[model samples]
Target: MVSVAMDAVGERLVSRVERLRALEQALLKAGDRGVRPAELAQRLGVRRQTIYRDLQALADTDVPVWNPARGRWAVRQEQYVGTVRLSIHEAVALFFAARLLARMADEHNPHAISALEKLALRFPEPVREQAMRAAPLLERRPRNREFVQALECLTLGWIERRKVRVLYRSARGRQRHPYVLHPYFLEPTAPGMAVYVLAYEESYFRQFVTLKLERMSQATLLDERFPERDFDPVAALQSAWGIMWSSSPVTVRLRFSPTVSRRVRESQWHLSQQMEEKPDGSCILTLRIGHTLEVLPWIRSWGRDCEVLEPPELRSQLAEEYEAAARLYRTAATADSVSGLRPSSGRHPRL
Candidate 1:
């Protein structure tokens, strides 16, 4: 009868709604690794054509679903409406990460602040209270306004894929130079972050140049767009020891005494590092990296406890630096003696 037909129609509508919800949830879970049509169809217990139609329906409803790569479909993160479920450990981890980012990020950067706010809003009341209590314990440094402005300008350029002309101060000669740059990405550094760009100079075609945000005097976005070349940030920094990327890769070996062996062995210092423990409670750490300039100070921090086992050039450099330091100290001691000042006493003896 007509009544039976109505009941059947209502059931079908309910089933359709359930299916759509399932599809959306699946796409959200897929994340960066997108789902395939066939995979989705199998998972949803539907035909491939049916899944395709559902995807088109979702798109029509303003859901941001697209093929990130050929044959793979994913829901864009921004369009996901599901709550981000985080366990206590994950929440705490994110809280610390946000705190660190807030400290290092420019004060004027709204995105970082907004993200932290959103994350805080997501926590349960108890966790939220805990986070509020912990907030005061974190030490946040004041933002550098000049650096913030430069960062914002460069970020805009990067997002638009536009070229930027900048007046940059060189770290080596302390000279300012004008250059046109294709803003690529911002890389995080020790104390803060560093911005790397593809620079186009009159003498150079396209060179990878690292610029400190504070060092840039001006950044003017240009209308000219650059082609998105195949550049991998990881590959570019594979051999680099910290940020000094000019030199060729060299295998460096250092022997650390027993006093510092445990400290050295506990942490992974470099990606290319290999450690060997000796019977005498000492250890040898080997690294294949580029440019030893940045790492020289780190090596020197270990002082007499660390010995350069390979790469005679590095050994010689360290020896020269140590000798210079020793001479300076000796000269200071001689000056104090000539001034009629006892080496151990607090005051100079009266003539």
Candidate 2:
């Protein structure tokens, strides 16, 4: 098994508990060579007495801290959190993220639970309590043997830089299709949504696709290895509204009514977003994103206050949906009953 290390990326926000955790990591890395209290105090910007007291505290907790000689303290441990440190704010953020992972996991995944459990030890107090709770909370989820095996295969393939053969079942159909893919990233969608893998298929052409884990029935880590690409998943997904990535992006234009215009103007939803205010109090929001599929749900959430203005295909699609719903409402009104809404027997009305 490979030991994977993860660290937060952000500015430091100091806390006593955080400092103690950082100190533990320092000694863990220092190993038998050890470190002097004065050096640790200097590095941590604290007094030598503070470092001495902290070392005592570590020993009190049965941390296996010992000194070979005067002022030289070292920690003995098999597993070391090399360079592990967390800003107070980062700890809180990670607490929420671990909570998200637990809530969104469909299967009882031991790997995810292990990660949460290990991460829980780094935080202090209330945040630690919440993060620790996630392990058991996620453990109680339904167990799917196929899904668990598939995930393990994908994880190995990704870490080893090997191709993965997956039997992917599409959402629209019952049939499962085979694909030999280079697993680039294992990405979880928004809160309460399924997890997906951004993989590249190099069969006939260079094609990258997002395959949902729930849709994968089986996965096998292939013997053939693939060379690592000099790719940054964050940058590759920059233009994506969600997980769909593309070299060429399409422009999406949305106009919001005056009622929700202020709400839209108040928040910056995406980095690629630009707004245009009209004299009539309405506003147009233009964005460049990979696909319209991911943005459709967001636009629909705003109801009639949001209008799909550009990319005629998208506008037409929205028009068709709204018109279909309007017909159902008319049918309900005619029936004069709560459950009276009849399915549209007519073709979608024109916008």
Candidate 3:
């Protein structure tokens, strides 16, 4: 009976929130004409008194809203939300950022798409047309309804300073586990093309843990509010090569061959990195990071051009991985040779 009552209350709260959003849109659309409380109530299927209280609530938040005349309400557009004025370079930068955002999101995200479209609408011409064309690119990606729901719940939890319960699966996990997380921050990674939530988990981690959005599902925003705590996300992730962060940082050194040395110098991989150029045209890059696990793949992508120098364990691990991969190819070559397969062309050997 208590559970049912709680659900009922939750439903009413959600309905009221939706109604408030609709009310704002209606008034904003009305502009100078203004909307009557009766019209809003009729549209939203709520009482006129409820619309009045909703307007007052919006006004309490300092929203530029007023009834210009009796029985009509409107948002003061000129004062409510000022016009955006962007120079050409600034406009181009924003357009590029929207393109990055579209690429970063795995699914069609309405909020991101709408934001891009709105920003593009105010851009200078030529670029404006191009920006508008790029805004709907995310619309083609398939929607993940469950992921959207989980994200919305987590967003609300963060804003309300509440705990959220989520069903999560780790990177290599076979089954989902429950976590009661104290919502702290929602972060994004461009290369990884995923979103992450950094939160406190008292049960397992006893500290902040990063949870990937793609791995999380079935999120519930709990009514339990948590006390405000000091957390500077920027400072926390200062040493992170990506989303992963920790208190301990390890020095990493890598030697790049002459072929890829300039390529390595072209970009700053990590903020803490330092370069030592060798006489043989090779260079050793050194950096401090919280963990080496996150950077192993990056090292492997360099293939033979990059060699680990400082961390002996990482060097040994990489060597073992290379050895294993070589053995697999060697085994395949032996099998093909015995089966009369041409060594180079992968065709039958001359009979």
TM-score of each: 0.65, 0.67, 0.71
Model 2: per-residue Cα lDDT over 190-232, one tens digit each: 7326777888877632777778887787688897978877777
lDDT of 1 by residue, 1-351 (tens): 999999999999999889998998899888756999999999999999999999998887777899998899998764445546887778778988877765554434555665676677668898776655534332243556666566766776676667777787866757777777777776655533444443433224456676776678667777787777677656767776776554468889999999999999999998889999999999999998877776887899899999998799999989998999999989999999999977875677898
Candidate 2, residue 20: Cα displacement in angstroms equals 20
How much lDDT does each candidate structure score? 0.76, 0.81, 0.84
Per-candidate clash tally: 0, 0, 0
Q: Give the clashing residue pairs of candidate 1, or none.
A: none
Query: What's the candidate order when arranged by decreasing lDDT?
Result: 3, 2, 1
Worst 10 residues of 3 by lDDT: 76-85
Better of 1 and 3 by TM-score: 3
* lDDT for each residue of candidate 3 in 1-351, tens digit (9 for 90 to 100): 999999999999998888777888888889677999998889998888888899998887677889799888898754564335787677668778778989877777787888788878877778678888876688998888767777888887776678888899998989999898887899888868888888987667777788987787888888787776677777888888888887788999999999999889899899899998899999999999989988998999999999999799999999999999999999999999899986786588789
lDDT of 2: 0.81
